[model samples]
Target: MDFNGIKGTYDVIFSLGKNCLVADQLSRHMLRKIGGVLDWVESPALPGVSHLLRNQFMNFMEFPNLAITGINEHAGCYIVRDAAYHIFSHHDFPLPENTPTQLLSYPELREKITRRVPRFLDTLRSSNRILFIRTEGTIHETAELLEVLNMQVAGEFNLLVINHAPVSGIVETPWPFPNVCALQIPLVPDEFHDNDYLWKTLLEGFHVRY
Candidate 1:
């Protein structure tokens, strides 16, 4: 797990930023893989030991809803308003829940709420919380998305972005924003190469859209 030279506790979520349809196994499976990469860094478990804690993300569509074929003691739904989404640790927050019903693409959702993006930055300017954001894209793309979530959360926050290795196209370092930093990871770790492949496969899926 590359720390990216960061140290501290921050408010963040496990999100692809690119939401895919649930029924679509490929998409859902991809998210699980992506989340595995994130968890590998966020809270890597010891060899042969389980993690002390974990979280679940809910995906909501035009009309969000969730069905359970199993039992979960600690569960919560993700909340969305005006196409903006946020996931909580539990249902006490009463977020939107669904049972993998309709397709929910974050790229498409971001397009519909493009005009509202600037507001997220404004919210960041006024708060005091830290945000650990996960991205399956480039640094700049991740930065832009983080700004939106940063603005939506009406509290003080910092941004910790987990992302892919740097691209040759972008040359600047130290990030444009002092409040933001990123850890270079991959969309999918090479199974044969990544030593943690076995543990990674154990990761579950979280459909929280940023």
Candidate 2:
């Protein structure tokens, strides 16, 4: 299960076979080195993370590597993006016309996600038994968010949840408080789950080699 000294790190270079949504996203993530499931496996092992990360789609410890043209920068912690790509790429997907994939730089992404932070904090204040923290960074930074929140929270919501995979579904996590639950209520309807059939339909047409 340990790929400690495996010879698999390489830049990603994949050709556009057919235009597909899931494939495109996977391609983008692979291009960015952020969406491949194997990347998560090679990531530093953290206690209890595998439970939230490993699912039917990406339970593999080591994925077969192919010729790649990107460095895996976030090799420290598993990315939820990769896990999401796994779930999404599992079903039958429909091919689309060739189109450009819109990628957000970390700064742009941070700004967009934080645009509503003020309004969100205002809403969080109304709830008595809950504490909410929302920050935009790599998906794995949920640990840092909780680390800071743990010290800040006095007796707020016993639940400390991080809804990082906004576009994809995530598994349940342990409650911060023994009796309290981590309430990671979504601000908007989860697009991934809301259009599950669409995703299921779109993932069927692609093959993932990483």
Candidate 3:
């Protein structure tokens, strides 16, 4: 997990959640060492663990319908408006069990995550250096995210993509921003979030004494 050293400190660490747990933990680690200077704001962009096979995240982001579709109760996930993926912990339903399906597409659905989208975009625009973490996703998924960001946010930035998925090795990309590092770390399913070696290498690269 040795990382090629780039330049200086990052402005923000934007995470595309397979779940927010990894991001939250990373923020804590940074907080203890670097204090609150680094931003790790929770936004509705990939709010929860998106099951890649069933509800493909690339499809969701690329083709945004703004339509509320059917729910997969077994996965405890529901797709809200603006393509937000929400997975309920402990299999709890957000609404009542027998709530009308049409009621799901009401104005209330749009209001919840709509405000945060612009805020996230604003954050992206303001920051010049970014450490984007795809906690558990593939290269194609990461590529889709880069495409969306390139369209919405202006200017180039130093991007480091630490993708903690079951990828074989370092994969190549066609994006112009040169400092991108797509890590080839295999995801340990049972011990999903804990990766001491990975973080140690990253923190060291950032010049953080861990």
Candidate 4:
């Protein structure tokens, strides 16, 4: 399928975070126009799709302290005031493994998953089209995630994968499924934290209509 050939509105626009930057910006842009899946629901460490696939109870432990690094303005892709430890990922504040059972006791985290997961799944299952953005996952990981969707979701949907790559323009589809179309924009990995304007400009191309 051709990238530009994708027609009609999307069911949802979502990303697995290579970091929070792209998801945050994309979600906000979509919200102002068409509305979309909440981007803050993912993490910054580039957790694989398997992490999300296998775990329902996202659990977390309080970090000992927050640390700041000067590498970029966004400060390591995720930021929560004074609670900046990698352990304290925001919104979806749960670690995937070895979590103490008590951490799941937090009503906040449990309620978030309970409320959001069903809506997320329903939106995907019901929509005729979806736009999935990729920044972190490798080719294989992307395929695995899509495969899960194929099995669980009833009825077929056109998938447009907007891959943020180092080189610009159209790139080969990582998974050659007939309903899937892939496009690449010139965005080096982790660059969005420092150079948000680039991501902004790319998204700006999706003009809002009256």
lDDT of 4 by residue, 1-210 (tens): 665555445545655454455567765566233332334533433333444533322332223333322122233333222232132334432343213322343456446546766676676677655655555555556567677667655655554455566675446554566666666666665564644655565554443232
Tens-place lDDT per residue, model 1, 60-128, is: 222342222222343443333212122211121222433334323334543433433343334334535
| lDDT of each residue in 88-190, candidate 2, tens digit only | 1111111221112312233432343244334333433443334221212233544543454344334443222323344434334453334222222233465
* Ranking of models by TM-score: 4, 3, 1, 2
Count of backbone collisions in candidate 1: 14
Candidate 4 displacement at residue 179 in angstroms: 2.9
Candidate lDDT (C-alpha), each: 0.33, 0.29, 0.44, 0.49
| RMSD to truth, every model | 14.9, 18.8, 8.2, 7.4
User: Over all chains combined, what TM-score does candidate 2 have?
Assistant: 0.23
Best by lDDT: 4
The collision pairs in model 3 are: none
Give the top-scoring candidate (TM-score).
4
Point out the higher-scoring one by lDDT: 1 or 2. 1
Cα TM-score per model: 0.34, 0.23, 0.52, 0.58
Error of 3 at 88 (Å): 7.9
Off by over 4 Å in 4: 31-38, 41-47, 54-88, 91-105, 160-165, 168-175, 187-190, 193-210
lDDT of 1: 0.33
Q: What digit string (tens of lDDT, one per residue) describes model 3 on residues 157-186?
A: 444555545654444333344545555554
